[model samples]
Target: MDSIKVMMDIYKEDRSMKFNIFVILILSLCASLFAGTADDPNLIGWWNFNDGGAKDWSQYGHHGVLRNGARVVYDTERGMVLHNPKAGYLDPNEGHSGHVYCGGERASIADPCTWADIPRSYTVLMWIKSQMWWTPPWPGSPNQFEKEWQAIFTKGTRGYGQLIITTVGTQGRIYFRARGLQPSTNDHINGNTFIDDGNWHHIAAVCEYDAVTGQTALHLYIDGYEEYNSPVIATGSLILCSDPVYIAGSYGGSTKDGEIYMDDVRLYNRALTESEILTAMDEPIPSDFTGDSKIDMDDFRVLAKDWMETDYTIASDTGGMVAHWDFAGAAGETTVPDLVGDNDAVIVGGGQLDGNGAAVLTGGPDGPYIDLGANLGNVISDLEYCTIFIDCVWDGNSTSWQRLFTVAQPGTTEFSTITYVSVNERWLRYYQRHNAHDEETNASNPTYVPEMKGQHQIAISITKDYGLYGCTIIYIDGVKAAFHTNLAPCSLDLLGQTSRNYIGRGPFERDPLDANTINIDNRFAGKINDVRIYGRRLSERDVKDIYEGVSRQLYFKLEAPGNLSDAESTNSKVVDFKDLAALVNKWLQQVPLLEDNLN
Candidate 1:
């Protein structure tokens, strides 16, 4: 980068570091300008609850104001979230209703871009955690709060779509209720899971219409899995209300009586497929495609591999493998058979083939990932020595929690071992939270994340010696990138006897300090070509043999963007003005991804 070079030159001249603050400021400004965003063109409105206010982050900048006692609370993962968890509506009236008031009438309500038209097909998504399920003490008067349901987001009146938290008999669930515009025919859809356990849950309500059948289906998804699908239609259209859209409560502020913490409320013009909803982040390159990182054989190799169809079978075979997944299934395949074991993976969303050897995952903090089943914990849990190998490519630069591999318990408590990359791309984490409520993760560091730019072969091995010292080795493309030796029990261990395992997802993705799911914690976006689990730790040589000694899973098959390298191969991918011309000349011959800069 020219800026970097100038800073470096100034630093060398001054030696006293008078320009330190300026250099840091420039670096920060650059990163912020290029940070990933919610880029779906179909998105009409988005309220991420950041900026400490209810500002719409989408193209429609219809900013909203808080209603009633609604207030923004700081969260570690999601900077700010609406904290409105009060259920008291009637007798005591202690229950405070809160919402983001997007002012206007009907579809025009709070919409400056005119994209918020009521449609027959639409998708609304949000993350919620019910603080409590409090009801009026005396069930004496049925003052509309008699039912244990409150609207989380509503468009207009009873004839429009709304997402709610309610009780089905005794099941605390995420519910969807919608009514067609014409005759006001209604559909009340119920979610299967009890969501009031004070755990954050991702929920989406989609109404899809088949033009041929003239029928509409309402689908409910909780935590990336579909819980309910019901078809009810006789020609449908949303009722046009003069009511303004509301988040955290109903249009008129009369609802949202349910107490819950909410964030990332989104509205799409049309129904979105699960893959689209959970798609990975793809940022646009500023100038050079290579990011001006390095230009070695590795860069050339990454460029070549970008065009060539990846061969999943090339490294599919490995001795002593307890399990392996060569995601070479067809598009729309719901099942990805485990190549070496009976632990076949069930696809919830977008495990479809990438047309290449890898499998596509649109990438989101929520679903459309490969669920390796609860039984996997029985086989892969609690091993002192083992190797977890993955062949994949990541699209985005950072995620607060993007799980590459995770084995966690399924219940409210999060007992799990998670190998992940957090907000910064600098380190690879091997964490073991001994208990669900533990405040600290045992991921004090030992592994490293390479300066990865494109497809890569990553192998993490754990070997314990008789001396009770654990050696953690991380290899990138068969070469040892980082290695550390630490006393046993201090390092990460997959505690025995657990049942939930997944690829491209985390066990809880919850903060150890607060135990709250930031929702964006496990949004691993990229394509997973192949994965292998060895019962024993892999030696450096063994790891090399499995990979092509080169630069090489989902949680989708995402084709990562390539980076540009300077003459020295410093692995600096940031494109700057100084190297643009040289990068263009070399880009034609080296990295063939001319389109990499476009997306």
Candidate 2:
């Protein structure tokens, strides 16, 4: 009977635990929904060089490249030094290892001595694993046994293990050594500890004192806990070694070598308190992203927060995708007029919209000056007022598209008339038949219109300017349409005009007018597809509807697999991550994701 009651109690506790977890999960979901986007600027910093070479440090101090580029260099003695995503990692040689060659004019790949010229009073944190041991003898040192080897080396006089955070000179040293009359020059082995076994340990030291200290004021953290500090008689002048500092080794006069693996080394010029240090050291494994210490949802929260920013390094190994508008279009191809990707679209070139909101559809008879791809028209509905995406040409003829569009001061009140047409049309056949908008030999404003004779991406959004007369906003893509006041039920009339027309060069109504200067040739250039259509007005949630799914896989026109083995094989051919992501986006648009409690 007693056993049964105990089992019942255990089951009750289990249920309670599950209930708590359920509550946490629900709260997390709510928070995620509310915290749609939160930019974290603290993740920004300069990733210094760790090339396993003496000169690599020169990049930061003198020739440092701050971009998110990684370099791996190996040396016979130094083992491996990894400079990736701007952080440094180093592995020791078989038996011996350290940064900076013991005695050499030139540094071999095995010997790297490039210490970053970090600021004074900074925190140094990193993951260290070692199997090298050194403890004071039982009786003591040759004279008196010290406790531990000094872990951090800074500038101070008569090397005393001051243990102060960010030691500057000879007085700065933390280690286990034999107690004795402290040796003056470099012979001072006072209080040095050797715990360099093969076990991985996190070592961090923060030097806040600008000068030497005698009390527990100087702090040192080993695997997150603060170690005892020695009495400060701080009065050394070790030159902070402004040049390349050493790792796993120290060199003031002679050489002190250490065997260990160093990974995730970081330095900050601020002294963290004991609580902060403890929090950092005790942080769960794989939790810290920037290595500044505290870790929680903030790390994972960065993805959506800075979706449009390139502040942190996206882990390519994790299949993380980062898209920035860096790839311009190729020559002789217009791009912006059509949809570029299943996710976001880039609206490249579209003739300017005048202050009066009038855009001459035919670009000065050069040809049809505007083009609204068939698929794109399907995606955009309820167009009233909204921001527009367009690449415009500065046709030295300031009067060209620019004069009336961008030049006018807002109060000009030009109220230029523009037209929005809803046409059930096919592809480019109409324009090609007329030979009007020629892609052959036409160069209007090549500067802004990089692909004048080619392709471009463009979008015209009308939701933003619904109420404002002669106002307009456009985007390359409108998964969810922006809101506009005084919006009308009809899409075209929402533009303040009751117009119904087909997709073709107008006033092709007669002949292509040369004086009109409106030509589709000046429209846009690009392949456009995945145009979505909505009956009612939309919102932000509506836009999210246009695309679904966390991952996208591109479609390929390949032969079918011969058998089940081929289909189920893990080694099956696959597209790259970038293209796959785009494909996933396309699939999301086609079949929206089901947002359920489990997700």
Error of 2 at 20 (Å): 38
Best by lDDT: 1
Query: Candidate 1 overall Cα lDDT vs. reference?
Result: 0.55
- Cα deviation of 489, candidate 1, in Å: 44
Model 2: lDDT equals: 0.28
TM-score of candidate 1 against the unseen true structure: 0.39
Writing each residue's lDDT as its tens digit, candidate 1 over 252-371 gives: 334435555788777876787777555411122232223222232333344445335342122333345668888777766667788877888876665576656677766665646778
Question: In order, how many clashes per candidate?
Answer: 32, 120
| Residue 121's lDDT in candidate 2 | 45
Error of 1 at 7 (Å): 9.0
Give the lowest summed-lDDT range of ten residues in model 1: 137-146
Q: What TM-score against the true fold does each predicted structure earn?
A: 0.39, 0.26
Q: Model 2 — TM-score against the truth?
A: 0.26
Segments of candidate 1 deviating more than 4 angstroms: 1-39, 85-96, 106-115, 132-147, 157-171, 181-186, 229-234, 252-255, 280-599
In model 2, the worst 10-residue window by lDDT is 424-433
